[model samples]
Target: MNPRNILVTGGAGFIGASFTHYWLNKFKNDRIIVLDLLTYAGNMSNLSQCYENNRFEFIWGDIGNSDLVESILVKHSIDTIVHFAAESHVDRSILSPDAFIQTNINGTFSLLNAAKKVWIDTPKENNQPVIKHRFHHVSTDEVYGSLLPNEAAFTELTPYSPNSPYSASKAASDHLVRSYLHTYGLQVTTSNCSNNYGSFHFPEKLIPLVITNVLQNKSIPIYGDGKQIRDWLYVDDHALGIELVLNKGKVGETYNIGGNNEWTNIDIVKLICSQIDLKFAENSYLREKYPQAFAALSGDSASLVRFVTDRPGHDKRYAIDASKSESELNYRPTKTFEEGIVMTLDWYLTNDDWWQSIIDGSYLETNSKYMII
Candidate 1:
């Protein structure tokens, strides 16, 4: 019932920014202090609206720095930590696994260590009042690995079977969170979410990549047969799910948050292409602004579809059974995939300057300009 002083790690990134906005707008009394490393994906512009709020503060830093994390926890009297910082891309992980190991594995360990030090051990050693704190880890359904067409959707009890370096690293982090809860009595909960798509999405991901490339008449690459299925969750819905977990979920529990909407890779791309073509037809200015979107102007953005070799160890499918979260926490995704996709496309089309800055590497300049250092 009381206001919470929350620390959001990686709060400038896509989903993290959404959560930060959602919390600040909904909980006027709660103070949000963000600590992010300002990596390539962490853009200050994403949180531009958050700067005006007296309850919001941004600190540019890394989660691996325990001393800094400890200082923030103590200084701000933080009671909840939403951990979203990580090296998240699968392709980047495959090409360079070292960063994944460092950021996802060792970095999570460092964070857990700091939380335990400040929240658990400090009180015991100093005989001070115990701090009421919770650490909520944000994880991916990719940690469940590939699923068969008929296999039951991944549930909270599903054993982790990670296939990619990214998923493996996330699986390790998930274990670390669980271990901390059982072994060290650090109140912790985790949510493994399906693919998230919404505003401020980086252009490299599938949905945003397709939207950006189609607008530029660039090839929309499909891997292998492009039938890999993924359950898509709108980013705002994921934020709401986390809110439920933080407010209602039991400690040491893991929740699966999903949209219950699944689409194949190729189908998702084709859908985007068709939507872009329709948008161009309905709105004449789209074609004028994106003159290079010749395919869309001709009502055939599908012309740009190109099948490419699949990445190594690519998962075949991922689905989530969020029944536990639904029944227990009363969590449900409000947006259907169709509505979410339309909104996503509209966001990208309307906010060219946002993704364009990322594509052209100008976002880094924006970060440096606004970064708190």
Candidate 2:
């Protein structure tokens, strides 16, 4: 069903912002209400273009707040909810698990309860049930934990074995979603996606961290041997996958979304460096424009790679088997890793001001702190 009134939590964050833009662009008639706490990672600038559209509205709030969430649901007459709000970083979760538990677990519970009250308890036009309501929970493949080199990729049926606090919290939330589906009959669908990289990604992530650090001639830190592998999905492709599941997927079903592009950590970093080198060589204007940044690319940017201690309980490898999603929903990622990385590099290179603002702490409060491991 086409969702007319939708609420997207964490719409100011990276993947959330991308999904918000994609949803607005795809469904011109639909209205989207974004609820975000605007935390350290949530940036308003990510959704700058959304302000021009009348169908878009933003609310600065937390999902853990039950009264606020319920009020927003009733006010907007929301029929669909695409939840993305969570404390997602592994390193941060390792340092402080309280936020992860609060935001990922408790916050999800609040959302589920609010959705139940609105979509199940409250009647619609003729005192009938809310027939078309859906809650699409955005989840991570990390919930499946690490896979051996010989093990098959994680599928929808993969059992949960979350490693870190972040993944554990997400696993708990996923369980809550499933319980609500079986016990309360709340219409719900879940998608556990692989690592996402592309535009508007926070610099704390692997891809953006490498790109930003390389541009600034800073050391590109690699954890352990940097051989840990991850299946990488472009952010835009992930957004599309979510939309497909929201509209075409069956209720109470889980879909695995992936780019089918897996690369080791070191390989990804070196590839980015190589791409930067080629870009600087090809574009004279780009080289002339940012001399220092360009000069940092004079030699191989890979020379800046620095081996660092790996974070505790780091997953060895994660791959996805999205055959179910492909056959059932006809979903497939369009961009290969090579193509997506180029687009990602070009975006970072061109949007210097965006990353610069982040580096300069313009968006973050003076006292704000982040676990930048």
Candidate 3:
């Protein structure tokens, strides 16, 4: 296959960064231009290793900026766009829905509009072969909303029943992408993934939050009995899933990407706690730095678990049915929950400076030479 020039929005964020690394490592000749808004969740250090690669370029910008989006597309001769930028946290959306609406809804519209303008409406280079451009949208399973205890997992045909402002915004964005594909004939594919956990994950999310709280000796907040269930997908597996979709998925189709590993909120916390306890037991040096951690003492890490009032409009459960992607794209998640959790725990334990900087608000002060568009 010929090398493709790809534009990746939100490539500095967790899942996007993972996809960026996966793509660059696998497709060495392809060039990638990352466009991110550098919001609180966007960590430049996540892509620090990519700086040395001549094929990779980082641009500090927003997907909502149509002019910048168009400029990058035309300038780089981009043939593929992997859209991942959005306001993703449910708690933050409940407190402030405006950012969610603007970023998730309007921002997606801007990207679609810019792609249509440049890739479809504009004139192509003289004597050049027709380039097939693709627009891949990364979405979350929350758009399917809560499921009853025995309800089947969400499929591609699942009717969206978004409960929170965050999910509503994402649902709307998903619709916008679909419209562009049907209305303007833009090549588009969407993947709705289960909860992703791995390195460079913002500490605000559940997995990272629990891991960091344990390391810091802080209370691990479990909302409203903590029975909320989510299917966990390792970030790398999600990246691989996207790669399959981009390479083989049909145009104008949506695929569900899941790990098929489901666990309740409280259960997840307990698992992390036990893992940390084992880590502390095996490594004596951890006790010195995290002296106050529950495991560092002779106490169960579960002792730090605290039950907090649940957020408004909390979804009771979310599970994905990735059979469509599995059969059609021949995709499957390689990491089991056990292997993924162990890897995630080791990442947090070893990379103190990474998460520590985020906790102390030092990661935001990124003094770098990456171009800011």
Candidate 4:
């Protein structure tokens, strides 16, 4: 059944904001209530267009607050919860793991407890049948740890072998979600997606970091030998995959969503540089439209590449076997790596002001302290 009232946590962040937009556009009759803490990564500007829609509402809050989550769920009569709020960056988690543990593990526990109390316990206490509710948890493939060059892609049955503190916290949360399903019989679904890149992505991520750094003529830091491979899924396609799992997926099941597009770190950066070169060469449309932005382009942006120390517990490769999601939910990525990268680059070039705010430290004065790199 289509969700009528949905609570989307982290709706101001990159992938969450993109999914919010996608859902509102696709389901006109549906209402979205967004809950976010406005952390460094959460930018209100990302949801500026969403504010104009009457069906959308934004809440400046955290998922760890049980009272707030319960109030919002009950007040809105929310039937679905798309949990996305968390500390997602690996580097930040390396520097400080406290926030990751607090937000990823404790926060998920609070959300699960609140959902159980409101949707199941309350109804049963009132001598009524359990309310139909869905708690869809958005997760990452990193929870399965690194894959060797010859190893098969990660599937639904893959054992949990998280490496870094970040992945460990998320793994703990994933287990909590599973336990809720098995013990309480909460109607829930989970999707562990590969890396995502598209518009509204924070500047610290690899793809956006490279694009912004290249545009500003800054050094593009590559960790170790830059051979770490990741399956890159377009943000919009990932949003669609989540939507499919929410609507068509069987309860108490997990789905793996991937782009089927794998590229090494160095290769991805080189491609971005090459695309920028082609776009700014001679009298291209992008060059003509944004001359100032292209003025720094020397058609050799890749020269800025600098090898640096790799972070601790860096995963070598992560690939997903999404056949189950493909066959069951009829979900397939529409854009190949080539097409999605072009679209992503185009968006970054055209929407400089959006990311500029983050770079200039004026977007949110409070968030400035959390800015890394």
Candidate 5:
């Protein structure tokens, strides 16, 4: 297996796509094989720009497909893997945990099993090995459960106490990844990160939802008092951190990546509103026209934010103690919350098609009952 060949699972989604794009641009010498099932959230439209690149290859497949996983690994001579495929939304996981279990739990084990066969069977380098491969698990901070308002953020030593089905599922995946390293002696590392908000993000998340809602003059919904606090990390910076960890991290260790940008849910919504007003003032003609189908698609401004019921088991605060990754891997977010928020709003405005289709398709599936929980 060649070191230059790497597999990035779920590369069509938000963070995965961003990371794939970044690597495609920066590491022209390396190749990435992206495997995504193209679930409602995974769309080829996002990666259309990278289709022509020889270093990047997109495969429509599930991580749990053992045959497909083994075939891709052997065919590509892949020696590295960045596992990013998972059902990540806390609210969605609350409604149905089955998808999370299948994708996040079973899917990861399938990959690990394939890797064990490939790595163990390969020739070893005297004391080292012929194929130097690594499995990097991308994870979330929610696995640590909620933090009290005045309590310290989640650090590496924080014990596992996941609240929602989503976090529990992720916590389970994290454990499996770690266990593979210890029990199987497979080369693995894990990173738990803060909330990532940036371009190409799904509308189910907060920042994009707020930006898109305000763009349509819809009321920005806030849960409870909207006082829940979260540490926001720009996806780009998080990508950089992950890349660094993949290349330079100690096997079996876990690193926490965050933006150091913390904000209450309400404050973020208001900030987005202010940015929207500025955008409208700068471009009055588009402002007069607004986005196409704004009235028919979403709704009026106040209707935008209808807080019917709070999501079950919502966490109060989630602040990442990202110093471990920062001090160890030289990772830090260059964009502050203000800058990242503005950039996100601008991206959404410029690339409405990317998100509009997501909302449209999501609306169509709104009637489908949740699978399991």
Candidate 6:
């Protein structure tokens, strides 16, 4: 099926924005429509460059809005759908599980129902022709629960053992997507990705959060000795993985996307601190004027590390076995952890205003003020 027009949900957020921009360039001939709720995490500015393209359209509405989604299907003739819209921040999910359940679980249900109407009602050209509709759902590796340090990574057939409100909600949605494929004969595929870091990232996330705080001479909070481990994948690579799965992947299958780079909480923070120090203080012109500052910051970068109360239900470790994606979909991560950290650090160092606005009053945690780095 040649999908001339496609609809991408949550295209205004971090990974979503990257996906939207990536796809527009990858498939220049196809038109793309984006739907987002523009919640605290969603910002239209992420996709502002694509706004003027005649092939791109955005609707500022929630996926849970059945009437709105159904209308969009009719208006755009969108045959391919890439679903990324959700309440994604784990911290926020811990604070308010209600919002995550509403958007992640219930919203997915609404999207499936709306698509059934559009795909089922279309008049058939001939009995020999199969339905050309495609539904790609974006998900996370957290749904597989924590892993031991040397444990094997998660695969396509891993059991659902989500530990937090955020993962649990995503688990439910993943089930719904799979059920639709089997029961209603909906064409669907899903990808569970590792931690993503890159440009246009929200401040609440770890990479941006630590980078922002360090720039302001603030303490970098480390939860529970900072021992938790995660596989960090660059957002652009992740965006590419999603497109690969949607395009060449088998229907009714789940794929894992991992960069094969693993780091503990402390190591990631220290790596960013070292990168920032070397880039700004030693590598740049400031080396001449602030040689002492460079030595002090680098030698004692650990001073900024502060062990804070751990998050409730925090997973000790997470890893993804992405061999399926690598072999079948020809997917591979383009960025290493070291290179990705430098890129992330440079972005925060350069773009202060973007993250500063998010760390202001309402979103600021109580510990955000008192820590010293």
Number of the top-ranking candidate, with TM-score as the measure: 1
Error of 4 at 274 (Å): 0.2
| Global lDDT of model 4 | 0.91
- Give lDDT tens digits, candidate 2, residues 1-373: 4548999999989999999998899898999999988888898889889989999998888898888898999988898999999999999999999999999999999999999887887665458956568999999999999999879999999999999999999999999999999998999999999999999999989999998988888899999999999999999999989988987899999999999998999999989988888887788877776676743559578888999999999999999999999999999999999999999999999998888888898867521322121
> What tens digits encode model 4's per-residue C-alpha lDDT throughout 35-139?
998888998888889979999988888899899999999999999999999899999999999999999999999999999999999999999989889999999
Task: Give per-residue CA lDDT, model 5, range 235-344, as digits (tens).
Answer: 99988988889877899999999888789987777677666666666676646657542532333333355554567888999999888887888887888888888888
Model 6 lowest lDDT segment of ten? 364-373
Number of the top-ranking candidate, with lDDT as the measure: 1
lDDT of candidate 3 at residue 85, scale 0 to 100 = 93
- Which residue window of length 10 is worst by lDDT in model 5? 364-373
What is candidate 3's lDDT per residue for 218-337, written digit by digit as tens? 899999999999999999999999999988999999999999999999999999999888888878888877887865356478888999998888899999999999999999899999
| Clashes per candidate (backbone, < 3 Å) | 0, 0, 0, 0, 4, 0
**RMSD, each candidate, Å?**
0.9, 3.5, 1.7, 3.2, 4.7, 5.8
Q: What is the lDDT of residue 6 in candidate 3?
A: 96
| Candidate 1 lDDT tens digits, 1-373 | 8999999998999999999999999999999999999888999989999999999999988899899999999999999999999989999999999989999999999999999999999999999966899999999999988999989999988888999999999999999999998899999999999999999988999999999999888999999999999999999999999999999999999999999999999999999988998999999889789998889999999999999999999999999999999999999999999999999999999999999999899889878866555
Candidate lDDT (C-alpha), each: 0.94, 0.90, 0.91, 0.91, 0.82, 0.83
The local lDDT score (0 to 100) that residue 308 gets in candidate 4 is: 100
Better of 2 and 4 by lDDT: 4
- TM-score of predicted structure 3: 0.97
Per-residue lDDT of candidate 6, residues 207-298 (tens digit):
88777766666778889989999999999899889888877899998999999988898888888777767666455553443344433355
Q: Candidate 4 or 6, higher lDDT?
A: 4
Per-residue lDDT value at 355 in model 5: 76
